[model samples]
Target chain A: MSARSWNLALGLVCVAFALLAVFVWIPHDVSSGVIVQERGQTNVGDAMAPTAWCYALGALGLLLVLTSWRSRPAAKSAVASGPRITAANVRFLALLIFMLVVSLVLMRYAGPVLVALLHALGANVTDYRSLRDAIPWKYLGFVIGGTTLVAGLLALIEGRIRTRQILLALIAVIVIALIVDLPFKHLPLPPNNEL
Target chain B: MTLSLYDYVSIGLQAVFTAHPAFHVLGVPISMAVVMLVAGLLTGLIVGAIPALSGPFAMAVALPILISTFGFSAAALLPTLAFLLGVMKAATLGGSVPAILFNTPGTPDAYLTTFDGYPMARNGQAGKALRVAQFACVSGDTMSDMVLITTAPFLAVFVERYMGFPEKGALIILSMAFIGAAVGASAIKGLISAVFGLFLASIGRGDDQTPRLTFGIPDLANGFSVTVAVVGVLILGEVYQAIEDLAHQHRSKTSPSPVVDRGDQKLHWHERLALMPIIGRSGLIGITVGALPGIGSTLAATLGYAIQKRRHKGAVPMGQGAPEGIAATEAASAAVSGANLIPVLSLGIPGNVAAVFILIAIDTIGGLNPGPSVFTLNQHELNPELVMVIGVFVIMMLGNAINWTLGSMLMRRLGVLQHIPPRIMMPLVLVITVAAIYLQEGKMTSIYFALGFGVIGYLMRKMQMSGLPFVIAYILADDLERLLRQGFSASGADPWFLFSSPLAVAFLLASVVVAFTMSRNPIGKTIIKNADPE
Candidate 1:
């Protein structure tokens, strides 16, 4: 199939999706069913109405389809010179995509350390000759090491603070009672556990 | 809201560009604005010299977080804007360094410079070319900055005094149509990309603040963050393209070209004087085209080169190391950097991708909306935005001076970056983008959105579609919707409301004509231009 054919398919897909969004997916709010203002009912609809946008998108998609249909075929050699199903390019794209997926999933499942680790691995998968002799490894190591140590310390402090905050309730209550309640009977009774 | 012209003048000048008494040594005061302007200029000189780190790349990496820092206050954004302006100007000049030294144009506008610039390099006049380019670029930028200062206020004043939402909406549509028309030949493809962006904008919320298109995804409740959308679609997309190119080259076994350098070159006063006419003429042309929305520096540069090619017969021959060619191309392209802001400052309509980013920054990050309101004057107080623009103007001037003194020194050292391979650089860029996206919304979920858009961007590029219109359309979407809503709402939903105003009718008609002319390009040239917007 030609590029025009591919464009046609894509344009059709876009039009279908847009139509679905406009007619099926669009939700109605409390006052969406009516636009009557005589009874002092106004703005009873979505603040960012998508109807106009949806129709516009659908029209644009149709135009794309027509454009693709009418698009002229270029020289065969030019088309041949373009990106083909080559192993090297495919592998490169796959690796990048794989890294992106893995990093995104790790973000959902693990802590920042895991995510950072993945990011480092992803960034490190580059041309060896381009980096090895060009950059000073000693400097890179120091920068990387210093960054890791600082990040680790900050994370550790933050984790401790987060985990310990609510767990200190009993000590807080005891201290509060000693300072104020123990001195007098009718001292505005500190709200019990709600405190 | 009324104020005297004198009050306006002082407000424009006093907003931070002037020295403050924060610190003093022997009664010499210092201000952050001047310092920031200098810093920004140096940064621009450095970053702009690198190949493939184009305007969108710079803006995408910075805008998301930068918005948080100042939050749109004119006084604070002014310093940052000064620095940003410096970066932009320097990019136009610095891009030529690689074009001259290694035959690599850093930005689309720099592409034409390489025609003559690289020849100069091959002929052992690389240093001369760089010097010529530096002079031409800065002169062009200064010329356009003057135009912006003189024209923007008058336009804003007119808008403030007269027009309403309907007229603004028509003008915006006119601009958008021109954008679709200006980028490449296919109005269909460009419009398609734009519509896709608009559709993205429409998703996530309804007019009544009800959720739509969220599909019950909790993370998407607030919709895609601007940072995710812009960075993913623009930066990450470029990363994909870079990686793809490297992969192809590696498989094909293409060797990197070795750069040639000749030492000790100086441009004399005689040569500079001879090239003055070319630079001046190109600067004029650039300002004229730059004032129009959608047409950008890249186009301006190409036009400048073509015009000069016809007009002048210079020493060393045209396209064979001619300094006049470099002067014309750099002058015109760099001029657009400042002139691009004309519509943005006056009507809040951004003309190109860079302007779009700035406009978005103003709207989303800054509290003040652009346009006539920014120029508003009152009995009690003058508009701070007017003052801010003046500060911006001052910063642009300072930035130019810094670029002149510092740009030449930095040009020699730029080749150090040429050693970094795309394989290493693109991935690192991706990592930074992911980290930034995560930092902004504090969610891993938005990274996924960015990743998805990145794929779309890669596909758009591979399919030979211009990604610029898509990104610009996305930025303009919110403003477009707001104006459209206001206009339609006030007209009681009458479709013919726009026809009520003569300016509105004129703008819409102009949009139609411009789109028609732009969309009807020769097929081959159109294909080439399609890839140029990057």
Candidate 2:
């Protein structure tokens, strides 16, 4: 995208946010007025600061739009092409988000799933939360989730995964889990606490 | 009934030295503070040598663990602050290692070091270059610390005596404006980032009974954790960008090769003496720039390098293997670490990212607030906060002493760390960051919040916005609101309280002027372009 278009897009987005904030969000969300009258005394209300900032943002956005519109694009080559969110960047962001979601799901449910699986296999087992503090049970979700997060990211970045990388990732996760868990027995790692 | 300054000094010294000994060395008992300081220094050296990791990242991860280890208590304050101060000081010095050895800057501020350092490495004078950096870094840091120690108390006292609520409010505004204007490429965007941060901060419970902007979410009522928001934006955001960069590089099949040490590695006494003038000038420049709220070490290093380059008459040109070049950049950047805290110690406003963490540590630990009140010397009694400040100074001195001795030697050997691929390190950092946050907050929601902010940070970076302004503004938002409310009430609910006093008016006017001027031609962009013409 050209510099002018980039500025234009930024300005429009800012203006849209400002409009929503001032007209919709603040009024609908905030319970107080810009100024309040209580027991014969006046005071600034919760909405005052946000409202003022919204106005300022709107003005700045308009200014940005005007400046970009007024400026000529003849010497575009001279101007530095600022940071752009390319298609590749978007794809990378999507992959990262997907990886994070999957890892988090595993972190939140891996232990419980394992416990249920054991129960199905004719083994006596209780709730995962009951055994969150127990050895191996506590480390399960964190290890699996943390390892997946690390190894998956490494694979994403390196464009390939090796067994050595997976092993290293597992070791890294276990070491970190131990470092947090050993000294501070009170501190629960990740999904253990949540469960 | 009143103790003298000497009495307070004695109290502070005793407090720092009389802590529970971690161990004894040759009949001498070393306090936990000292031990932590040494540990933090070593960790800082390693952290700073890594390409993508930085001092703030180390501080962010250490803070939660430190808080957990040393619970909220007066006794815990010194050791915790000491460890952080150690990390802050040593990281600046350590960052020069990669810049000098492999030409890849370990931190943004260290980029200037590459101008002269890489060339020195190519000339097989990498050892001498590292030595020059070490001496310059320690010397400049010591000088800045001296200035901070002497000036901070007096400045804090002055602010306490003279400044009222309106003045304080205006001062914060000025700081926010200055930071926004000076930090990023576009002043408007920087201001927008800061305001957005302020808006986000206003989401939680305010003066009113009802929580603002919560949208009725139970978690929103309590507000976003500062650590989660800041660490997410500063560290995770950088991690995300770095991951993308690595992926791109992998696809392109390009990788950086490591440089090996070859030649003269020692700095002679005469050579060290000869480089003193350049170091001194750069240190002064750094101190001046750092004392301000928004202008950071990048500009300091740039200005230092530019000024010295004009005056340089060495056989090798400034950008080419000149030891003076290395000295100038290293001294200036390292000096910024200490001087940057001047505003934090005196005015209760964080001047930079490191100062923000220091303030956060103080807040989390529940003692010794950084402001004019901390420096208020009571005639009838000894001020404990003042003593804590003194203790902090003592810890800084210890850090510098360590830097002068072991830090330089450790830094010379950190060349191997430069070879560690970012592809591996960044992912590990992401996991460590999440785990650290989880350990601290013990809430999965905090992790989610952090990742959410991390995405925001990544977007902000891609848009060329500096996260420093956003993070600083977020931290200061509560203080700003409190001051504004108090100032408004004190003026009988006058709407123009911020502009009521002469000092307040001056500050607001200056803020506006600065925003307008800097918006047109940002100082950061100018200096960066000048530093690297290509």
Top candidate by DockQ:
2
**What are the TM-scores, per candidate, against the unseen true structure?**
0.82, 0.95
**Chain A alone, model 2, TM-score?**
0.92
Q: Write the residue-wise lDDT of candidate 2 on B205-307 in tens digits.
A: 5877878888888888878999998988887898898899888773434544555667557799999999999999999988988898867787788889989
Tell me how far the alpha carbon of residue B272 in candidate 2 is from the true structure, in angstroms, after superposition: 1.8
Q: What residue pairs are clashing in model 2?
A: none
lDDT per residue as tens, model 2, A1-195: 876777778888889999999999999988989888878888788998888778877887887788779977735564455746778889999999999999988998999999999988988887787889999999999999999999999899878888878998999999989988898888888877767
TM-score of 2: 0.95
Q: What is the lDDT of residue B160 in candidate 2?
A: 83
Query: Which residue window of length 10 is worst by lDDT in model 1 chain B?
Result: B523-532
Per residue, candidate 1 scores C-alpha lDDT tens digits across A31-60 of: 253232435523224433466656766887
* lDDT (0 to 1) per candidate: 0.66, 0.84
DockQ by candidate, in order = 0.12, 0.73
| Predicted candidate 1 versus true structure: per-residue lDDT over B1-534, tens digit per residue | 567767766765666545443466686665667766666666666556677576566666555445444444555576556555666777777788778877777777888888898898887777788899998998999999989988887888898777887788777778777676666436666666776777787566445444556777767766787667877777788787776665445233553366565775798888889888999999987898788776678777887888999987766778888899999999998888788898988887777667766776666646456677766655567666666666677778778877788887778787666555444445445555654454445465676789789988887766656676777777777777777766766887666777879988998898777655665556324423632455
TM-score (C-alpha, index-matched) for candidate 1? 0.82
